[model samples]
Target: MTTELTDAELLDAFHRQIRLSGREDEPAPGIVRDTDGPVARRYPQEPGTSYCMIESPRGLGDDPDHWIRRQVDFFTGRGEEVEWKTYSYDEPADLTERLARAGFVAEDREALLLGEVEGLIHDVELPPGVQLRQVDSDHDLGRVDELMRTIWGPGRDDGALTREMRADPEALDVVVVEESPEGPVLCAAWLRYSPGTDFASMWGGSTLPQWRRKGLYRATVAYRAQLARDRGFRFMRLDTTPDSRPILTRLGLRHVADTTPYVLDARRGA
Candidate 1:
């Protein structure tokens, strides 16, 4: 006889794995909150850019529309524009529609993928002179920021990134792969851990156009996976674009559900 795992069981198992590794403690770039009420937390990306993660109001007689409107009011009162990320499992059905009615626009859907760190870790070879290092100092953090701007295209201020990295050294574990001979090239970063969940998220994995198709990206991912495993984390999770879907699939991550963001630009009326 074979034991079978239900979807909920699989999700819970993955969560436990990430929590044990302590990677969930990785510091986010902005303020994080775990409070009472419908709004779980707010992540401020920059001066005017913010996002909210709501507690799924599956029970407790909570009204999704009411809770969402409260969140909008919370951010707008502070003069911050808000983006609300909703997962497929979110309850109080038609939450997205409610957000739209409240002036929040629907964004493209992306996969909320989960996988075991054990499955993702693999020995991969890097090109000659390309080295992977864990960032530790202010200078390393600055370099990581520069690399991120180069790969992802610039917008947000780097000052916020610097402040977050300095405030909580343990909150972030930035891994970089620098190419020799000219300058540092191709960099990636991951939130080693998440608070209250067993999931370490991969973020800011960008490669310069010149470095495309090389194994640098894969190596960076593997390095992070190994780090998670070393810390005893069981699961790794990420929200990815279509470009990264194939690469993640090769690493054994499975698509668990879709995540969509609804945005309310409070600035429009301001």
Candidate 2:
């Protein structure tokens, strides 16, 4: 019998085994994984793709302030826009303010939600005429991109997304809900499995405006959760917006921590 972990324990495991851990997920071609500093960094071949995953500043000893400034200058000097992901429980307190002082603009804060796969693997009854299925073809992926643009905005690009999908398609499961097989995509989402980790992260569950509140979101979630469990992962993680927090909470995901991205767009003044 598997022992249940408390939310605190789950959060700690997530930080130690996933957030602060070295890269286990495969990088796309031309993407470099840099671990020379106190944090894990991913420097993609293109500008605006580089980012740092920092779980805490304790690794920087007593002068995290200096480290923060140096990091900001490092990325900004390269004319590359980089995102520094920070967590609420990250050490040295005032870390958010420090990023702000160093010219990093804060973005929306999201709840880092965690849920057990066993608890989440339940059947969700979809509304009439809607169904969920995994997609992978270039044509299907292009449709997924269009659906995302409709949900997020027209300015979003699918180049980076399609590139990542082509690099390692097995690492992700892109699922969509439609009126019928190969029909109009009413809702869509994807599950990314981090190799060698016990977790799979959920992304992109946006439904078309007309399809909201009819259980499409929950159905996609349950669909992904089932896939994650079948693949030997024990937990599911989501960086959830406020709108999805209450629904996820009802589905047994605990809000373990808050995460905000601080972006340094060096290209702005260049």
Candidate 3:
């Protein structure tokens, strides 16, 4: 039997395999460029959307603030809105505060959770009449949009999501659990297979308010974990809220770190 990796081992592997690998590969519909500080990414199709992935803020040296401004100016000069993602273990300790001081607004903090695909692989019995299936068609993707809006309200856009799905269908798997084959969607989630790595990341996993407390959320997780395992992926990662932390912990995922997105909308000035 393959030995299950310890939490420390898994965390180290995450940085080595996912974070470092991301720097080299350009994700579909996006561009990844390594800067002196963080790795910068811009989604050309998304207009003003960009991201800065800081693997280690310690490397920012004594004048981290100067480096931050450089990144802000680099993107904002082009009228782009950027998000700087800060992890709990990242250095200078006050990275989030520094970003805020640099005009970035802090978003909700989420637990960076990871799990072994083999350990998370299992059959989660869905409530009778509920079905879990993968969706690819634009028509079915519209259903995903409707479900997301119903749960998260308006202002959340999935245009980039659907566009990416259409651009590279094999890179992503979108799944939804429904009340029945013809029923409304109860829960929806997706798995992104990171190129050149053994890791697959999970996103979404939102359930309707009425569907909470049931196994719908867990069912979606299990469904995607199985898919990852079948595809030879060894690990599954997710950024989840504290509310779902306990539930995911019970499902064999470990709390690896905490992450918060500090966003700067340059068009709004600042």
Worst 10 residues of 2 by lDDT: 49-58
Q: Score candidate 1 by lDDT.
A: 0.67
lDDT for every model?
Answer: 0.67, 0.78, 0.76
lDDT of 2 by residue, 1-270 (tens): 989889899987887777667533347666777653565566766665534333343355588777777677766666777777888888667888888888888999999999797777667888876778888878777778888887787642365457778888888888989986566689989888887889898988989989999888988888899899999999989999999999889889999888898887776665
Better of 1 and 2 by TM-score: 2
* Cα error, candidate 3, residue 239 (Å): 0.6
List candidate 2 segments past 4 Å from native.
Answer: 23-26, 49-59, 155-157, 181-183
TM match of model 3 to true structure: 0.88
Tens digit per residue, CA lDDT, model 1, 1-270? 425444576656654454223232244556565534644545564546534444442321456666767777776776666667676766656777777888888888898778777778888888787888776766766777777777666755564556766777665678878864236657666555654554567876787788768888788789898887776666678888888888987888888777787777666466
Stretches off by above 4 angstroms in model 3 are 23-26, 30-38, 49-58, 180-183
Query: Which candidate should be chosen as best, given lDDT against the real structure?
Result: 2
Which ranking of candidates, highest lDDT first? Answer: 2, 3, 1
Q: Which of candidates 2 and 3 reaches a greater lDDT? A: 2
* lDDT for position 13 in model 3: 89
Cα distance off (Å), candidate 3, residue 135: 1.3
How far does residue 237 in candidate 3 sit from its true spot (Å)? 0.6
Task: Return the TM-score for each candidate structure.
Answer: 0.82, 0.91, 0.88
lDDT of 3 by residue, 209-241 (tens): 988888888888888898998888888888899
